[model samples]
Target: MELDDLDWKILALLQEDGRMTFTELAKRVSLSAPATTERVRRLEAAGVITGYSATVDPQRVGLPIESIVRVRVRSLDTPRFRTNVLVLPQILGADHVTGDDCWLLRVVCRSMVELEQLVEEAQRYGDTTTSLVFSSHVRNRPVDISIFVGIVSR
Candidate 1:
């Protein structure tokens, strides 16, 4: 879908606050509530707006420790390893990537013992290199849609 300036503005506002009502968004974008709602619905239908979700602080929710686990799996066990990782509650996100490690996982645990246990369970599938996160500088930032305004993709 080709996005205009108004659509970009609507996306920017929605990214900042997903819960914003259509009336409020319409006011900001200088459109009628019905028009804004239709535009948002079209964006969703086009898969530009995937889903809305709340951002929560993992530490505040009692899972304080965060670790990045780089996992190297045997070629034959890759599928089984991915299935195992999906069922592990401590894993927040998993990425299949290049380099030495086939998978990178974002994990959160309540304590060091829990982290150890999680890693031990993961070891059955692959060799893992885990690094504890001290602090995050930036995370979950809104995408800049301005760059794609007039770009044509082949």
Candidate 2:
């Protein structure tokens, strides 16, 4: 979808806090509340705006250790592996990337023992390399819109 600086501003605002009302968004974007609403609606319709989600702290909910697991899955499509592999609660997320590793997984575990267990579970698929996060450089920040895609508005 073609978006202007105002639209990007709106997205930036929403990314920071999704609960902003149309009135507040209008003031920030320098548009009328109705206009802001229409723009957001159009962005959603065009698929530029996917969805909103709350970023949670894994440490607060019991799991404190976060590990980035590099996995080389024999096959991502294997039903057996997909089923059993996904059942592990420690796994925060899994992604397929183009590189030496077939999958990159995020793991959140309560302790080192659980982290080891999570790695062992993934070992059956392929090699596993775990990187424990000490401090996050970026905290679930919004996508810098200008980088990945171009936007030009009327």
Q: Give the clashing residue pairs of candidate 2, or none.
A: none
- TM-score to native of every candidate shown: 0.92, 0.83
In order of listing, the candidates' clash counts read: 0, 0
Model 2 C-alpha lDDT per residue in residues 12-108, reported as the tens digit of each score: 8898789899999899878999999999999999998898787789999998899898877777444655677767878878787888887788889
User: Please, what are the lDDT tens digits per residue for candidate 1 over residues 36-126?
Assistant: 9999999999999999999889999999999999889889888888787657988988888999998898999999999999888778888
Return the top candidate by lDDT: 1
Q: Which residue pairs in model 1 clash with each other?
A: none
Among these predictions, the greatest TM-score belongs to 1
Q: Cα RMSD to native, each candidate? A: 3.3, 3.1
What is candidate 2's local distance difference test score? Answer: 0.81
Worst 10 residues of 2 by lDDT: 145-154
Off by over 4 Å in 2: 76-79, 145-154
